[model samples]
Target: MSVLELVEADFRAPTLIASVENTKPPATVVDSAEQLVDQVIKAVGKNIVLGAPLAIGKPISFVNAMYQRAKADPTINLRIETGITLEKPVGKSKIERNFLEPFVAREFDGVPDIDYILDLRAGKVPSNITISEFFFKAGSFMNSPQQQNYTSTNYTHAVRDLLDKGVNVIAQLVAKRTVNDVTTYSLCSNSDLALDLIPEMDKLKAQGMPLAVVGEVNTNMPFMRNHAEVANTEFDFILDGNSKPDHKDYSLFAAPHGSISAEDHLIGLYACSLLKDGGTLQVGIGSLSSALTYSTLVRHQNNRMYNSMLSDLNIYNKFPVCKSVGDSGKFDEGLYGCSELMVDGFMHLYKAGILKREVFEDLTIQTLINKKAISTDVSLATIRALLEHGAINETLTTDDVTYLKRFGIFKPYIKLVDGNIIAQQETASANLSATDTLEWLEKHALGEKLIGGVVIHGAFFIGPKDFYDDLNNLTDDDHRKFCMTSVNYVNDLYDHMLGNQQIKQAQRKHARFVNSGMMVTLDGSVISDALENGQVVSGVGGQYNFVAQSHQMRDSRSIIKIRATTFRNGKLKSNILFNYGHNTIPRQLRDIVITEYGIADLRGKPDHVVYTELIKIADSRFQQQLLADAKAAGKVAKDYQIPKEYANNTPEAIQQFYKKYTDQGLFGPFPFGCSFTDQELKLGKALKTLKAKTATTSGKIKAIANALQGPKLDHNTEILLKRIGLNKPASFEEKITQKLLIAELTK
Candidate 1:
């Protein structure tokens, strides 16, 4: 099918069943890896087109088994299409190979390994097997052969392109559990492509095309219901080896909450201030998202604290935009969430009742909604406004009457006939002049029932174990509130074929697509997915699509949050570059560039204005260099100067400001929620400090010398050292390093 047709096709919820009835069941349960390889060899034949979901949904056992089969048989021509294959890159340099490698291994102990990624990086990928991906997890494939030959495509189009290439085999990790004495399966982590692919595969099978759908059942995969849950009948085969004691837990990619630097909170605070009460929001992963969620909570639950923070930061005075755009009060109207990945932050917002805003399908109705002229509780005044705005005709037709009734504008018992309104044993003029008709409509309208709109719409989700647990524990009704659809629908501004009148933009109003970037240039161009040196950091995921959509909406914005600076090899570096060779969201598409220092409103701004605003938000240490470059390029006047108010935009100032808040119990690293304990948090910080010290030769020597000096250790310090496996070392070098680490932690 064409991309448009595929998108326009109505999606039907898969039937939830206890067991497979009509379809053939699995012929055999493969208990061993060798057996899995043999099964794949038989099922795949000589040439095969294999498709798998991205990230956590990838069936590692199946993929590795296929890899083994491909290695043994060069005649097996296999094409694999997937995205976001997570792999840890073995470092190349001394610092990376020595310090960083061991640090990561110690930090992330249980994370699974994707053999294909390692093979691709080592340039040992079999010539017979081809690996293709649409979007990658940030920096997962940078400077590797896989990235050099990466297939660049939008998230929405990726599925279409893969299917067009004749993807006849589908494999995904699934959650299996017994329901009413029957084993049922759920697509737990990812339903992004599976929702579309499953239905399409059914059609292909009916057309007599060779096809195979395999579900690798892992009990560790949280069994979630919602729209993702489906019966085993959906798949032709089920790999149920997870019940074995030896089966390992699918490596949960835990993005441990990063420390929320003062700058991060400031950027988050500004972003939160721009959000409207009843608007639509789109936020991605990371500490910045967590900060924004926390700020939003403060705005809703603790107005006094929120307002005080804003005042302490001099937000309204420092940035005039906050005066008009910032909202210090609570969100009575709440918000709607539409994001590519529904991160844990949204859950916090939802729990706080800040994500309860509902939107309807009709554009005319949505416009009325924006103006606050209409609501679920329809009244005479609302009907009059609709008529006045030309949304409805004076002489209402049957279709108009139906539309009005559907949206609660007209009461269910009321009827329109020949320019007249008819009620129970009463009649009035259809011009809305009759008081009785108005009162009847208001009294009988379906008030909040009509407010059944989706709270959060996401393409896919993956987070801490608690996030999965929360999803699994949601009530059936509450679960439906978090809809899982394809990226094509969630990321785009308008799905022309969504409903009637395909011409108009079809999206919730006041959309704020908040994304993260590595660096932003003086001209407001964003560098997110790659480096200026032509190395891919992350693939261009859904950032561009959302940014484009933000411009298309009337009261929408594309908010790109970037740290003002970053530490590289023990040295601080500015993230606001004078110029960059590559661009993710170009200068033309730039909207609101937010840094810890301030917000740079670039949407439709002149080049000079853009430069000035960007410079104001840049790290104070690099502000002069950036200004000089802008001046040389003739984008800023030679005599122009940055305001003195922004001169305190230094790391020291940020640290001091953050310390004040920390005393008041604000700006915690994991603001919204955390899975770590207090001790772990402390230990993590100490480890980070030690890692930094080990980055340089002189620092390492100093650290070793300090260890030799023999600082006394407390019981708690010894316990902490044991927790990180540093209490006793096996080798002489390890013993020295352990002492150094113990000293660092104790200090």
Candidate 2:
């Protein structure tokens, strides 16, 4: 049960080695790609010890490849360690013209080890030969008992069963981030084995088991720097590849649109009111997280102004803002980040001169990272520049300075000249005292800082490049200090140093942490099950962990912000329908529900009030329909109408507000960095639409032509036309006509 015991349990096993004669990636990986099919068939025929994690974009490719291999080698047993099976819709929504027929049903109908097929219609896993997992989202997550015990129990049994049956190698395609920590997993750098838990690796290694761990490298994924990393040498064979998954695009999914909602604003507003100028902050990703961060930034920038005027002025009652709060408007101590999703917002906070706040670690060395001693090659320079530019204060104490130096943070009094460290003369120990350290740090702190408490550690696509870069660059001692799971699991060990004032404040500073997006409602119960008609818009991720954690933490609230409506058939409809065929967070657990219209404080509200708020945010066009349904169900009165005040503040009105501001050049699209050309914008929209459309060959080709020959008739247009399935016309007139069509489209 203890991590130490787990490590000791499986420390040794026989090493399974497979030398790949060909290391090059297949040039043309298709459903009928012969080379890959041949390789897989050969492995199956030989009854390879394990089946590697298979990632393929085209569902048919996976089905065909697996089907062929299984047919050729009946005796060869197959096991799938990772990845998910794509499920088509059973019933049609307005979005789908017809009920989508199952595509891979034929391949899986009688396969012995096909495991389980996740039926999207039913939230629960159906009884099947293989395990059926309805939701399989990839991310850097925290490991709770559910993950460490329940999830691991199934896996351990499966692996043990295989081993007993004489299967030697268990090839699994785990998220690259889940392996041993680069910060912690570095000690075994020279060892040719990859492991999930230390005890397993140690046990198998000790038994002289021929264990071969494959490092499934997804190079295109966003790499993050954390107290975890896996050395390249640990994996016997590194299978480098990429996958085209239907992941949440941050640009389209940012605050107020995707995950962020109005309820987040309410909670964030409450949290900001509680936070003192120097307090720390931690938030998960999504609309609510974004709302909290964005609201905090606005407060700091606008000189302690309130964004929305709610009834409670609990601001003063919560935190004691200093007399000179405005001058030190920024979250001076910089809020530390503590949430599972270390998203773009966290990075933005740091870049905005707020992330330089103190990090509190249980370990002394990690205190250095808290003090920013172990500097990021990119963040270090950026933080230093901000300090010099008056964006942040440069008043770190000698203890802070010393720890930073010990941890390799080059700031304040030190400068790294051509890779050599140098101490600044003005910041020498001879000139400082302990009192000055506290005063200086507090006085010179930024507006906000975010320190996160992540549950799941690694996955494809969510980490930063700098995080991986730093882990790879760390020295052995540094790596040992940084990578230890004990150090990284700060939340787990928060109780160890409860008396510490900083840690206590850090715990309290948290406002809210959310579960992942989209909850289905079934018989008035809310659940997060894509299998139950809820398309897994985003994975469960670290939602349950942080939400539960926030509930336990003092002065903190657990908030769930959901769109009042979901986008279906090119229209937004009430997400809270008569029957939420899918439920994520049930009504009992639902504390807060937000829509663009307003917040539904449903925590203890009666069924009547809950109905009121839910319907308030529903689009006016659909509000009457929802009301009729609710009334028919006896949840509300037949005469119940959404208060006119609520109706007055609809999304149409919200859009109007933006349009007015846009006319005055106040807001429209990218208010910050991005520059969009008309052609580019149109192309982007076309691509987005195409992605949402039901995939058909004719539809796909038409989309391609519209994107290429229908954007602009410039030189680039000519190139695009040739690149797509379009053939060149013989006459100049035909070309001119095609170009005219493109010109019209662009206009």
Candidate 3:
């Protein structure tokens, strides 16, 4: 039997709400994905505009069932509008398949595939079904039709776009918690956009448009508190079988830490130097983010080593902007995380005691904290500042007492009635404006510390399995420090209705929004998400939003890190080009750019200054050509020559620098952790070499000839071959492949 058929008895679809419940109505529970899909179709009609969160929060079981139903019946027009539809990596060649398939199976055991993605990959997605994504998993869908339907909007604008696209249904994978017979759901990994989208959907429903919200409780998912926690009635329908026999419990998808190259470590070191203490931080995923996380830990946990490396590397003398814009001291005051994507690196930061700066939502408390007049611990000074800031009146009203008590500025035992402050109706102050009331308030009103303060305000979270475990293991107090909020709060300084603009500015002081770009032009513009000829390597997810936010904030700096050089199609190429056909971020928003060589301060600079500074941090091999191009374009002085210090900014120079610190036990390739073993690591390198050779005909021919001339393989070679199942060399092709692989592995 097919996996999707309902295991429970037949039941009719329940009526979905057309308006938001004034008081939450009980959700109708379902037993199977097929039954859920049937209810969704009945409630929302044939034209189902389904909205799902990006990444891990998607309920794939429901998604696949819906897609199958749509496929089976062409009359059902189903549109899956979301981002980052994660598909397991498929090998491009027979040899690559042998090298990677086993690893994929081991890593992604029991993970169900999205039926639409499988069909889309096979180029057989039915015309009735449309999959529109705002983002892709970076270079995962370069040439697919995903580029055509890519929603070109900022993260904050996703709700607006979804509304315009007529999204009538929202489905998510949620985590359920039970307390005293009461059950509630937490959005968990994806409170990001949905927190904002739900209110808009309610507005739509109020206008009599039919809509449904469905949730599938995934026991594997961690139940997050704060804004991610929602009442059970928020869902129109629910699927809450935690441990039924029919339920297929699969391993939650994991993003194992990738290998961070030596150059990437240097880039991270430079980038981390720009993050100030007690500031806000924003970082994305992958090796660079992991490198930054590792370096940040080094700065916090081992400041002596971090400082020594910086001074030895001549960072302050060479890139003085780091000292000016950021600092090289321990994060004694700590940092607050306000990011769109809460990657695994953030967990590393949190574990190292680096992510500890807590920001309160109360504008009065936050403003005072930002001004250094008060701390998270409420004091006499806090009351004084609140009075001075005109946030409160000397004559405390019942409203003022309630307001103060909400933030724990007032003790829990205290209450106000008829313009008098009382503690359990026994201790009373009749006149709050009197001089005696000041001392009375200080003695009775103050609490130990600020309540409801959060260290990390994230829109969504995606990481490895262990990362989730770390979250699940956090103490309730520690967990409360993290608030899984909406993109409006984390991604931008707009949304004044929520006091976001004013409060966020007070919270996010000296923010360093670190992101990655594929390339930067000589003029300082960056090409991050797309390639030339309009093929998007990835969608402009939240990079543009953060860049714009950086520009809007006085102290916040947008830091875009590039690897300086990339070996694409088996040839080394500069990521800092003279010009690029596409630009994700234009020159006007140009801020700080970092490469392995050094940091380039491009904010508020002339065109010549921007290009000149950028060239100094570029790879040495490409500097001359870039300089010549700038001269040809008249963007820089015609006679300007490369600086002697920067002229040696080659890969060999980086290697020497890397060697200097190797003995000091720093800059490991996989800084966080890795999925591969020692032998597998060696085999991974060999596979890369094989891939590079196989990229071009001439390269492949040369590789084959070198394999023919090379010495015969020994027992050591057999071990590597056996891992990829080429130990026996069953065919002529297999024999040639083994020889080629052996040549690379032994080298």
Candidate 4:
């Protein structure tokens, strides 16, 4: 929608006004975190059940102050409920620490540490302070003291869970903007739970329960418009970082991008192909998302290159699903994103003009657009469609006039009052059934087009610093296109507040919800969140929700991407196993699985067919063993033979095929851009290799001993050595580490 239309559409309905009047925010401002903490204690009491947003949207200083106050007074029982605690990496070994400490300080200079999370990591959280989360930062909290305090719930259910836990205080980070003495706030990085939680909290407060909805304002946060915007009155205690010293603005915690391997790139290509043009898209973080994003852009902007790669890989011939359900063609209609996490990928797509499929909030308009019965242009046909759909009556009411004006169906001067239609100079009958009245309205009242259409609807965002900057730099009009909303609205088709089932179905046509999984059993169960031991690798954040949602949305498909094989204890093993002890997605939910080698369409397939299809994409080295295991378990037919054409599903083969593009200066490690310096990148690769080679004690000693007698360091080696603080050996331990680095560099 045009930026101006967003303003025009802001006119609240009289019906909704009464319903939301009592639940509006207090809009009181506080000077500092300590002051806010004082207010919180007074409002909710010392037994503070604090609710915080996950990831970078957390207010670090405010949370720290709350924790410190609670710690200083054991009587104050503080329990923090949040997820994805982003802690700066601290290496385990001396050499690693030396390398990482300096690097971390440089990369994360202004990012404040979460004091309680740090203490929780050290197993030093006070007895009265309990920290818990429904999501983890992948493997971050596996061995932490609070690992047992995990909450297993879908993203859509977090608000319900938080309310049940009697969360009395909601401390959220927000972006503030003031215009002509009127100030407003944007949920910015996170609108996920708060959009659903705040109203419920207000209801509790109305019932005389002590509760506070606090906002910690940060100017560094991008002030996204549309759904993300909230009135200053919505927050009871706002620490305005813009004008307050105690709540001074700090740097956003940037989640740096990692290298996208060739395998991941291929997987992305396969997955994005299934993403139909003009459909809905949702993806998560990591190299796979980057790869998929890079390739999808290539497919849209440089179709020749993308098509050539697809043809060279013979994707259409081998994976029949790619031909039948997907296409190598460019996205002519673009896509709309509805994801829980708005990863940097969406930004890339948005910039490249691929994320431009606008969806509207009004069910009639959205359905008409979806059915191709009416376009965004509000012509005579749009009026006809609305009349036919019973969206408006022949005799216009005040509500009819408001609705028509809100959607820009009528010109600004056109108005309905006291039973008459005012059209500039001439008055007409309110009844559009009168031929002359309809003609006069169409000639002077109808507007040019629709407004308030948003291309992306996401719950939260976390990405590299560049992506954040781009978001902050967006023009007000462009910013409105990205609607940061609630997880329930973004991740489910069942949400009723935004629209009904028909409207949602129309908006999400041909949806492709792509997600990454760790493993897939031959029976088609997907293992993503944890291992066979039931240890939590990461929370099942929103993958399951989108996957399940795809089944309910029309013409939608759930594509699960997995690396064909992975290194477990330095041993290569097929990720597509015969069976797994745990599963996040059961066999019945299986649809499509993508790997570097191939795509496996598991939808509605029998056990034998599913087994063979999975085996077809498994690493060639383990295919025989996997097939045998499947046969032994009777999952596959005893007489089933591996297809000769698909027998060359090896990593080397995958690498060699991708080398064709990488050699041509395409498909680089960091497809979008690299965060690491050239020198840091070199050292990081060498360090990882050394760490792997020295996994055994004997191997480490032998390598160090060999390095002691090695030749002098070359100029490049010296430069890299200096980068990681090993240019000179200052101690006995440093001397040993220096030798190890020299050996790895030389090798």
TM-score of each: 0.80, 0.52, 0.94, 0.94
Candidate 3 residue lDDT tens string, 1-747: 000101111211111121122366767888788899989888889999999999998998889999999999999999999999888778886766777888888888888888888898898899999999988888888777767878777778888898898999999998887665656678889988777777677777779999988898888888887777776777888876655677655567888658999999999999999999999999988899888998999888888999988987798888899889888888999999999988888888888788999997767788778878988888777777888888777777766776676667888667777767887645556454576777876776678887767889898888887898998888878877888878887888985434458888988999999999999998889999888888878788899999999999889999999999987877889999998788999989999999999999999999999999999999988998999999998999988987787788988988988888877898889766788777778888988878877777888999999998887888988888888888998899989988898888778
Score candidate 2 by lDDT: 0.39
Candidate 1 per-residue C-alpha lDDT over 391-471 given as tens digits, one digit per residue, 9 for 90 to 100? 777766666666666555665566777877666676666555566656655655423344224677687777766776677
lDDT of 2 at 252: 9
Better of 1 and 2 by TM-score: 1
Judged by whole-model lDDT over C-alpha atoms, candidate 4 comes out at 0.83
Error of 2 at 300 (Å): 4.0
Worst 10 residues of 3 by lDDT: 1-10
629, model 4: CA deviation in Å?
0.3
- Compared to the true structure, candidate 4 yields what TM-score? 0.94
Q: Write the per-residue lDDT of candidate 4 for residues 1-747, one digit (tens) a residue.
A: 322233344355321111223446457787678888898888789989999999988988789999999889999999899989888888887667867887788778888888987787676888999988999998887655566899998888999999999899998889877665556678888888887887788789879999988899887888876667776666789886456455458888997779988899889888877877888888888999899999898899888988888888787888888777776777777898888889988988988889989888878888888889998888878878899999998788878888888777987677777899897887888897788877887888888877667888899999999999899889866875788887888888884565566777778888888899999998999999988887899989888988899888648899999999886775567898988899999888999998888899988888888989999988889899999999999887889899898899887887898898888777889877877777778889889987776766777887778888987789889988987778987999888777788877877
How much does candidate 1 score in TM-score?
A: 0.80
Better of 1 and 4 by TM-score: 4
Q: Mark the regions of model 4 whose C-alpha exceeds 4 Å error after superposition.
A: 1-10, 13-25, 245-247, 418-420, 423-443, 697-711, 730-740
What C-alpha lDDT do the candidate models reach, one value each?
Answer: 0.73, 0.39, 0.83, 0.83
